[model samples]
Target: MICIMLVVAVVTTPGTSMASVKMEPLARTAPPPVEFKIQGSFDPSNSYLDQGTATISDNGNQTVKISVITEAKSSVASIGGTVYLQKWTGTQWINVGSASTISASNDWYFSGEVVKPAEQGYYFRARVVHWINHNGVYEQGETTSDSRLVS
Candidate 1:
């Protein structure tokens, strides 16, 4: 479970007018998310799915930013997987157009933007598949992230 703590303290002068404020991350801890589950077919060496995260931001003109962080075990890459960005309809989850191929490397971070309905609430999530070794015996490990609502 990834835990993030952000604390910002703003001090202003009596006669000064502040136009902008910049705040850096106070404390950030990235533990394996509780929602990520590994299937039995996956190898133990690449089982842990750490730093799986998703977020959406509005940039006006009906544009929404979607981001996902796929890291396993340590900060470096430990597995290869396919990261999918999906959107939930009223009844079912549908795959969006954006799909990222995460090759085994040191930490994989993917971000994309889509034009969605403005001011309408929708659920979004990331689905990742950890591809086992490329040897003759290959097994796939899969996991889905908890949904986040974006309006």
Candidate 2:
């Protein structure tokens, strides 16, 4: 997980490819395949992006705002597959937010508030899986981001 702040990271895959990695039976020797890749903005507005930030809110229900980057490469190709937002209960993190898959043929802007936010003072994380062409699994998936603390 090379963190230059933000890179278009490649997620876990199902089958084997030159860039494939097995996350089910994770090989201790293998490393996390997520990377903060420099992106060329398709729009004539920005030049480059270094990172992304996921802002979580705890207003009434827990909500999360993901900063999205368009015109990205295969780095984010896998990340747009699945999103599972969870919050730490007393013992374990429970699914208290959004967890679903949607179309990503286009750019996925992550700048939106979710329905349920994480619990106050609880730990939260967003799990993303790279589905191959919106299929079941990717040749590679990783829990790239760490568990963010909910406030």
Q: Best candidate per TM-score, number? A: 1
Question: Residue 66 error for model 1, in Å?
Answer: 7.1
Query: What tens digits encode model 2's per-residue C-alpha lDDT throughout 1-151?
Result: 8767666776555565745553332122222234463322123222221223333333423344432222223333333334567654545655654575533443433232234455444556554433333233233232323555443
Tens digits of per-residue lDDT for model 1, 34-97: 4444432344555444334444555443345544344455434334556676666655667776
Highest-lDDT candidate: 1
* lDDT, candidates in the order shown: 0.49, 0.40
Regions of model 2 farther than 4 Å from truth: 1-62, 67-79, 106-116, 134-140
- Candidates in order: C-alpha RMSD to true structure: 12.8, 20.7
TM-score of each predicted structure versus truth: 0.43, 0.39
lDDT measured at residue 34 in model 1 versus the true structure, 0 to 100: 43
Q: Count backbone clashes in candidate 2.
A: 19
